[model samples]
Target: MGLTQFSFGALVRTRWAYALRGSQHESLLNTAYALEAAIDEIVFIFGPILAAFLATSVHPVSQLFVPTLACGIGGAVFFSLKNTVPPVLEPIDVVAAEIPDAQSNAVTGQPAPALQTAGDHAAPTPSPEDNGFRLRRLHRPYSAKPRNVLTYRGILPLLVVFVVFNMSFTAFDVSMTATMKAAGAERFLGLQLAMFAVGSCIGAVIFGSREMKGSHWRHMVMFLTLLTVGYVVFRMVMGNFLILGVMEILTGLCVSPLFATGNLIVKDIVPARSLTEGLSWVTTAGSVGTSFGSTIAGAVLDASSPHMSMMIPWIVTLCAVPLALLGWFLARKRPGRGTGRATNTAA
Candidate 1:
């Protein structure tokens, strides 16, 4: 599952870069992200309900096959669309002038031609031989050297913010479940979760349609602070179902926008050559946070009360604000490190 998700994420990022490549890239990317988030939440809203129905009406293990079948069909359709594939961009360092004609022919096991120079001191323009050499180099089977995406400034702190933010969201889920079960209203758990997804879908649509301006760091700080406040409200109203449901929807309003902002940050900081890997790292961080959050929240719920479990998310989210501020400071200190405007030729 991890491998599959990683591949899918990389492909999605590559496609987005290819399709949205112009002056309006930022706005179009935002809309694409919003649509993606909305569709994802819609799937989440239905997937669990369907799984529950299958578990109750059919065999205990039948629910698993639904996702397997869906993935198979979806993968088939997605991969079959050949036109959507992005062009492979080679590094600009391997120019025609760099490799001599003789060495290039030798690498390809072909006979070498006589060398021609413009003059002793004049700069030699690319000849037919040089062009051939460049073509061969472009078509060669050699892979470019791998670059470490984490070495980029501000990326680590941005990822840390995501990790903690996702941990809080996942913990909120466990706390919600604990609260519902303790209240003897476990059947409405699906409804409550669906409300959160619905709210997120709405938020994604609204946020995506707008042309947001200003620093992404400030956007993140604002969203995180708002979400933290929502969680606090969640803890306060856990005992009241109606009020809790309202709070759940309100809190969810920040979820998709926050995720979209994080992806934008990654896109801004990481070089185009490493964009896919950088985005995949964000997905991986979210997965890790989800796993840890659920485990910790479950343990806390078992040992204490739902309110205590809820506190974990509230406090975690509160801590994320300072981390985001730190990221902003670090990014400002380094002028061109993650400016996103400069084109990096190095892979």
Candidate 2:
């Protein structure tokens, strides 16, 4: 009925689209998303023209309705054009069902023993450095459960990094709009966003076209540092539209690459069976960050200058860099190639 509900629906729809795209590819998923993100930015290039046209209409919400329709039609065409049918998990893969005792245990409603492979027998050990920190200890419940060990090591760090990254993004977005409006160039907002998208397109193409060697976790920190630099440069040009557009190109290039890289990294790190779920958590973290970012940015802009509000995003971006680096460090000790089914294999 309102913008809130429409936004929530769109969020759900986007996650579904990503998951669908993910299911269709084993390689170059990041590249595909990167190219698509670039093309999507073209919409913003035409945005001012579209907004001008829509402004002449009786209602202002035509802007929202048009994009929503376009998205729906696009999704329909994509699904209809797909050649392959979705795969079914076959009965033979259920080792639990084949084992008579486990089947009986399940039928009696008792918990079945978790199936363990040869590799899973080894336990996660703390590094010498980890022994120095109190927080390094797994919490009470997890520590109490000796049989249940943490499978994915990068998860906690990834979660922390994504939350901060999205928070910074949301804060920057809102603050930029406010700053632009205050400066009497509200119309330039879309252009700046488009320019950013253009930059992202370039990044996506470059990274997507190559064979990325080593762990993706390492590149994530590098990209995040680029993001921080962009934000810092952005602060200098906030009062100047021409310079802002150029800055957007530099900053915008970072977006899709970051997202594509993050997506690929998630795919690499999580088990194949849980890929969609892992990606969904990224979406969830973004949503949570957006909510917080919006509240914080709106409050700051009201009480202080846009320049002051701008600090929120850059600070958050700075925070994400180290967190991502930490995640990178953790990934090494954890050691998963993140190539879906091959994660169990040694690097």
Candidate 3:
């Protein structure tokens, strides 16, 4: 059959996969995919050894068949289901307003309501700031909208806590990899990485599905605690390859829900006008934290024994506890923790 004839079937399959697992599963799926990649890397490292052993055997062609079939079948399955599905909105009475006099609306309007912009859509105009505070008088659209008059005094401090916790997390990825290599656990490194990604996928599936939507902060707090425990576990048992991998995986798994729920919290407390800008700052900060983590881990590893280097990452991660606490405190102040109400159009 022609490619066109099979296109609908492909779309149906993609939609089904995405439906059974929400788009959030896309991140979890990536975790599983990274495990598969780790497996591939392992195979690449071992292939030459196998080839040399088989060289003197009776049938060398047998090896070629397995690799070929594996590649072909995997490719066929993935490509057959490579289709993008649009978001299905559950009927929502999204409030819309009429623009009275273009110039009047431009002068007095607030930032336009968050909407999915297409290629033709224009970016919103920049807000005018006065003495560091954006002036509400200059933006008519935002000023006209119904102001949500709710304040949770505790939320600001919590944002700081979340930021600190993230800095610690950023350290883990760099430190763990180098420490494992330094400790002569290099042979099992591939397996360790595989487990890390697989565990994260499991975590994402657990939280991304039904368990997270209602009252997620309680669960989120529990997850953060798990992350702390996981780090401590690593600190206690540095040389044991198996235990290190398990701890890393556990730590990695706890992170996804924290991230997803944190984004939810940011949408709730901040002014609606600053939502996008706030998220961008959060992302940029996390990136910076990771970069610092790499540097810190590298410096520690270079200075002392392999064991000492491994301990530093764990220490840094533990210090980041304040940030997690701050995030939790802020989240507590905000109502509907992870209920998804505040997240509407936030993404």
Candidate 4:
């Protein structure tokens, strides 16, 4: 649900940009954003809503498949639309009938301009310079050059920080849902998640504004430290759903800048061709870490009390304080590295 809300809101802005810009690249990107937003919205809203309604009016487990089927249909519709549309407009060449070459001047060794037809009257062909067409030449977009691109070497460490941070948080998230349900507070869990998404959006906007002004890796570290404090507050509030929701929302607002900063970092460091692949690998690493966290958290639930589940996320999040410090240290060192000098104290 949290992911869906963020995705949908971004898509709204993206689609408008594409429509106004009328650029084929933007259009294709916007279409993808729209389809992804649709699928995520359906998946996030349908299953939980169905579970809620069925728990009250129908057999919960028996009707679960209805929502599952809805998700499948929604996904299929999105996929079909995606396939129906080409990714973007392809550059095409329009050809005209070739005119036979005329004899060259013997002394100057230059061919005479050919004749042309205009309104049934013959006209001398214009020179290449006057005609604005080269007989044989190569052309490419200004955006194509290697130096105009960024690469993974500059961005890999930033991605590493992102994956580590998200891995720790995702672990907390998996445990959070289970913990809330165990505490008999499942009714408000969806709403809490939605609020978290809202906060994240707000945070992203704020971070974007600041990034436009200048970079702030030290500030990010401070923010993460503060977010860790919020987690501590969250852990202390055991049975209160309202408090849990509020704290989680605050946590989202605090940490989302860090999430968004990763993208900015990628944009700075990665080349256009490899950006998607680099981001995918970063996400994959985070997923693997989340899986580990989930397994550890879930295992605690099976063998210990529900309250004990908070330990995993808390431990993992705390691990990030040192990691954040390291990130800040590296960021400071980055500028100095270009000049081959050490400026700041080491982490």
Return the top candidate by lDDT. Answer: 1
**Superior candidate under lDDT, 3 versus 4:** 4
TM-score of candidate 4 relative to the true fold: 0.56
Query: Which residue pairs overlap in candidate 1's backbone?
Result: none
Best by TM-score: 1
Please give the lDDT score at residue 293 for candidate 2.
Answer: 88
lDDT tens digits by residue: candidate 2, 257-291? 67666666566566544555666676667778778
Question: What's model 1's TM-score?
Answer: 0.82
Predictions in order: lDDT: 0.78, 0.66, 0.52, 0.53
- Winner on lDDT between 2 and 3 is 2
Off by over 4 Å in 3: 1-163, 183-188, 213-218, 271-273, 327-347
Work out the TM-score per prediction.
0.82, 0.69, 0.50, 0.56
Give the better candidate number (2 or 4) by lDDT.
2
For model 4, residues 1-48, the per-residue Cα lDDT tens digits are 424322223323323333434344432332333333334334444556
| Candidate that beats the other on lDDT, 1 or 4, i.e. the better one | 1
Q: Show where candidate 1 strays beyond 4 Å.
A: 4-6, 23-26, 93-144, 335-347
- Least well predicted 10-residue stretch by lDDT in candidate 1: 338-347
**Candidate 3 lDDT trough over 10 residues, lowest sum:** 1-10
